[model samples]
Target: MRLALAALVLLLAGPTPSQFAPAQAPAQLRRGLASAEAAIRAAACDAERRFGEGDPDANASRCEGVRGPPGVEVGRTSARLRNPRNAPPGWAKAYLAQTDGKKASEVEPAVFDLGDRVGLLRPIEIRKRCLSCHADRAEVAESTRAWLEAAYPRDQSFGYALGDLRGFWWAEAAK
Candidate 1:
């Protein structure tokens, strides 16, 4: 009878360990990427509030972000999770590639189900803000353009229309 009961439990539980090794890597990466994107958006909003629209000062500022609730910065980018870590390597590389010298950009978070690991989502470009620093010669402010030329001699991250995808966050995690 005991053996029968055990067999029944196993049947009800569905797949056995040999059948399916739980995959949590994707989920984790998703969660992390989402949190990071939220942080970037919030930071951009905060900068706008603190300075003003089209204010060059906001470009150089970086706020310490919290990953989960209550704003913890351990590894997560928000004030939520207690154990957030830096974005995966691939995510970072992808994000940088998309930056292209735009005004502001944000990346989404990604997660894998294999090992509950986290990764970075794609980055959303700040279309309007680029005008202030990367606009055409007639549109961009003289001072800002001068600054760009002096600082980034080979800057090619300018002249984009609205609603264009600038960059995306990429990541890979252990499974």
Candidate 2:
């Protein structure tokens, strides 16, 4: 009778978390990382399209202050000089190394941690279309070239072959 009553109570209590199961941590982390990745990718695509349309400037400033879900902080940068704020801090350099030289990066999702938070690293590669402004000798618009020269005097992100790891998006979520 006690077992039956206990079973009934448990059934009425709805689904209880298992002792060995984490309480929504994994789900929250997955959702956060996914949202962050989408946010960064969309922002990058918009910036790329604008740049292709003759606006020759980094879009990092535009994406600034764009926050991900509650505890997720997202941002993007390159290993090159295009994004003046591309300096890799902490374990970001290591993650970039892991992603470099690989044509198709197999992202190990939510593998990094920042204090009590988790992180996602997404590799960025060069496409043939990106050569317009990034090729060392491509026939870029004179105005755009001059603007780039004036903006980034020591730019070194250009002259890359397609499939090159241009950079990566680094995002973190509270664990």
Which candidate number maximizes TM-score?
2
- In model 1, which range of ten residues has the least summed lDDT? 74-83
lDDT of 2 by residue, 41-97 (tens): 565666575654455445556564554455556676666657576766555655555
Give the best candidate by lDDT. 2
Give each model's whole-structure lDDT: 0.43, 0.59
Cα error of candidate 2 at position 152, Å: 0.7
Angstrom error of the Cα, residue 60, model 2: value is 22
TM-scores, all candidates, are: 0.42, 0.59
Model 1 residue 165 distance off true place after TM-score fit, in angstroms = 2.3
